[model samples]
Target: MSARYWALIIFIGSIWGTSFLFNAVLIRELGPITVAAGRVTIAALVSWLLFFALRKPLPRDPMLYLKLGLLGVFSYAVPFTLFPISQAHIPSGLAAIINALLPVVTVLVSHYWPGGEKIKRHKAAGVVAGFTGAALLASPSLAAGNEHGELWAIAVCFAAVMLYAITLNVARSFKAIEPTTIATIAISGAALTSVPVALWVEGVPHIERIETWAAWIAIGVFCTALAFQLMYRLLPRVGTTNFASNTFVTPVVAVLLGVSLLGESIRPIHLLGMGVVFLGLLLIDGRILKIWRKPVSGTEVVSPR
Candidate 1:
């Protein structure tokens, strides 16, 4: 890959990573349903407008609609709901640790997909280690106050990350469909689902305040619309392996914004948890030093062209 490509990935990771800060701010004044609803609703509206301007046809196949709807529900609606819920109790860093399992979960999910990446011993080890870090990170939040209740929220974060992993694989099916189509279908469907829930639960998102409005805008534009566009552009280049590496970058970004912008604090355990999680992901991906030292064998050696 070119340096430009690598830089793009890092940039995208950073933008998406900062979403935790945006989400935390928004959730302060809005209910989970309202925040989640606004993101997909606004993203859907914007994407569909773009598609309309381009005269793009919506996917005709029923299966595409089904995938889009499912994608919208799990990837957008549920996870959007989860982040704010978890942030209500736990810090974003802890939520990030639980999310760090994304790569490991993606690897595990790929195994069941037809002709997907074959699971190997190294990947298996990575998955186990990564999951361990996730468990450790969740511990503090659970232990602090009504541990079980806090744990339930953290569990929602876990389920959201798992769903994200599934979406990473499932999104390949959108190759024939326009990227906008997939995003449009998913976001629109999610928006519709969220509307009723938001109305009933949150009642229109605290419209009178400035910061509340800012939070809503950030969720809708920055977190939802812009982030998906960036993801679409980069995913094909990075492929899944390195693409999953974005999770490693996201938490650091999330932590910085959480602490600096949201006035959230960090402790030694959180830093230690970050280290342990990074170590686990490194282990999961395998030791670079060992792989570098080994010489290419069999028919794979480079030949003079």
Candidate 2:
């Protein structure tokens, strides 16, 4: 990967990683559904204002809007809702760690994406390592309290990852449009689609807690809109493989956020697990470790049909 790609990776990883901290803080204050509603609402409004301010016209094609809706529902709306619900059942740290499966899911989904990255053995091994790290990350939580609940919520986390996998691949076709515009459409759709449920479930949120408001604002502006826009901008330039590598790094950053900012304790096992996971990510990345693994010659490319 290029240096620019590496920089982008760290930037994206930090933003996404800290999202767990945001979720944990806000969920405590506002509850899951309400927190999600507030997040999407805030993101939609900010993006819309930015969209209008930039004087960017909406897509002339209505079909694009439809596509955006599908992408939004799958990518942001469903996963956004399900994640918090799962977090309600599971711990936020565990939820974030379980989300470590994203690269594996992304690789699996890429196989079906036309003109996308090739899935190879190293990638598979890396996915295994990532899960190992994730398992280590969640092991204490899983072993100690409410194993069934944790397991159940982890299942939902997997579903959310699948949705994310689909959305990342779908964004490839949206290259004709700016990432910011696509983000605006997606968040707007999510806000509108989720409003009824939000109203029915939570009814006008109080938004009294400063921590809750901070989390909501961060999610709306940084995680949802800015992060999506950044991901979109980075993807075309760096290619999806490098962009997807953020999946490997985000958990580490999340763990750091939990420990440092939130004052959560970090166990030795967690560190050991992170080391193994990093090794796995190296296996997946095809940059550094591929050299030692030696090169495979005579590559063939087939178009997705």
Candidate 3:
């Protein structure tokens, strides 16, 4: 990748990492449902504004909306709500740590799904190592006997990652649609899904704090809306394999922000688990190994496709 692409990926990763920090702030005054609802709502609005500004043509197919609606519910509403609920029990850093498993899990899903991507030896090993790290991260909470409901929260976060993996696989079926349109419609569907649920359950949020409002807007605009735009821009040029590098950057940024800004403590186990997960991600990425494989007898080493 060029310097410009690298810069863009890192910037997107940093912005995405701050989402957990913003969620922590919003959850102080907002219920999980309200937080989720507000986030998708703002993101949807901003996305539609961009959609119009870009002068993109709308899809006339009704079935497309149906598919996008399902994407919204799975990709945004449920997982978005679940994260806040989990963050209530666990630190934002821990949430991000578990959420980092998306790429690994997606690899696993792709291997099994019909006509999906096949796993190579490195990716298979990556799947094992990734789940092993997940187990390590969860061991402390599980051994603590769920006294603080951290175990359940950890499970919920894992569930969210699984949903994300599945959504990613499903989204691949939308090859004919523009990425921005898919994002816009999906976010709009999430807004439509969550707002009613929030109103019904949370009974309308009343926020007076300036910081809370700022945090909400930050998450919606930067984390959700802008992040999607960046991903769509980079995906075509870099391909999914390179784009997956963002996963590694997110957890590190989340942990740093969680510790420094949110005043959360990180355990040694968290660091160890994160390191193991990074190892697995590196294996899947194959970049370091590619560098290590030197040419022999003047024959160039070629990467596996």
Best by TM-score: 3
- List, residue by residue over 212-296, the lDDT tens digit for candidate 3: 9999999999999999977977899999888888888888899899999989987899888888888888888877677766544
Clashes of each: 1, 0, 0
Every candidate's lDDT: 0.76, 0.76, 0.90
Ranked by lDDT, the better of candidates 1 and 3 is: 3
Superposition error at 191 for model 3 (Å)? 0.5
Best candidate, lDDT: 3
Residue 46's lDDT within candidate 2 is 85
Identify the runs in model 2 with alpha carbons over 4 angstroms from their true place: 1-5, 89-91, 112-118, 132-148, 266-273, 293-305
> What is candidate 2's lDDT per residue for 15-110, written digit by digit as tens?
888887888788776757677777888888888888898898878888888889778877887888788878766555556666766767677678
Query: What is the model-wide C-alpha lDDT for candidate 2?
Result: 0.76
Clashes of 2: 0
